[model samples]
Target: MRIFALETDINKIKQKFCHSGESILLSTPYHTFSFFFSSIRELFITIALFVVGIIAFIYDLPMGWTLGVLLFIWVVFVFFNLLKAYVDWLYDFIIVTDHQVILVDQTSIYKHEIRPIHVDNIGAITTSTQFWNIFPFGILKIHLKEGLGGDTVMLKYVPHAEEVAATITRAVSSHQSRSQTSAQRRELSGIDDSE
Candidate 1:
């Protein structure tokens, strides 16, 4: 899939480091119900319009006029969808290097908020899949650490959220393990110096 936008600092940091010794993985593109449902609805609308155009031609209505109307509607639909896709793509809740979680939310070109949470500091991870959001599909509400402003991140509508949660948990645990090992190494080095 095409990457529309990546965190600038994240990119810069990765380039500066020669090697992390472990691969940094990011999650797949996720969208809200509104996005997926609208796209699906547009497909149906396009099909219905095609059928109507054929019917108009058969009934001796001006074929050119019918086609023009359909074209106009399609163009409008596409324009709106393009905007929606861009916004949805920008609004991502991301985990980076298993050390940080960043939520990039864009309200407009000039208005936005970027929240960063340290994975080591995270207190808890909670997930909720609501029935209404399932609509034609379900979404996972991933809440991380209470009391931290905007600590919760939604994966929006996705398939197999349990598997995704498992993946995230593993990443977080791995980071935790590395941190612990580093602390222990530091302590051992200090003891050797004391001797």
Candidate 2:
């Protein structure tokens, strides 16, 4: 039963985004560390509010009930903020296909941006690490041609960034080879037509 549901979901995704002869080569969300980093501010705020609520309750302050109400609201706000952060982290993914690379940036439940770059437009791919490689996460940067969705697309906190970059590089080269073969065929056909 579970496998059936998973298959259905996969089919739905393929139908929605994939074209004929196009297959997904790689699809990965940002590393787990990114989720904590993205929601760090909210976590700190929640901790501070919780401490204040505890102190107010312990002192039996005159306005303790009001403070409790305010803290309750603050808790809700923090919960939603963390939810948004998780949603952003989980949904924002980099997908490499045979024909193109797709970046899905989901900032919130209601907002997302999809950037698709054809493999031919990708000029260069590089990876960078933070804090002298202390962390396992790294960044993947793809340099694109002019007028192709700005200059570069950077994916932060990517686990195994080097592997992902290599996969994209391979995809780009594969696309170039296929394009050359097709162009040669077209040129040969043109000669035959002229003859």
| Model 1 regions lying over 4 Å from their true place | 1-22, 25-27, 30-36, 78-96, 101-117, 128-138, 177-195
Cand. 2 TM to true fold: 0.85
Error of 2 at 145 (Å): 0.2
Worst 10 residues of 2 by lDDT: 1-10
lDDT of each: 0.59, 0.79
Model 1 Cα lDDT, one tens digit per residue, 63-134: 888899988987787646656555655454344446655555543344455565566656555555657544
Candidate 2 yields a Cα-based lDDT of: 0.79
lDDT of 2 by residue, 57-167 (tens): 778875657586867877687878888788778766778898888877766656666677889899999999965778877989999887676588778898889989999
Best by TM-score: 2
- In model 2, where do residues sit more than 4 Å from their true spots? 1-11, 62-67
Q: What is the TM-score of each candidate against the true structure?
A: 0.57, 0.85
Clashes in model 2: which pairs? none
Query: Which pairs in model 1 have colliding backbones?
Result: 134-137
Error of 1 at 150 (Å): 5.1
Residue 80 CA error for candidate 1 (Å)? 4.5
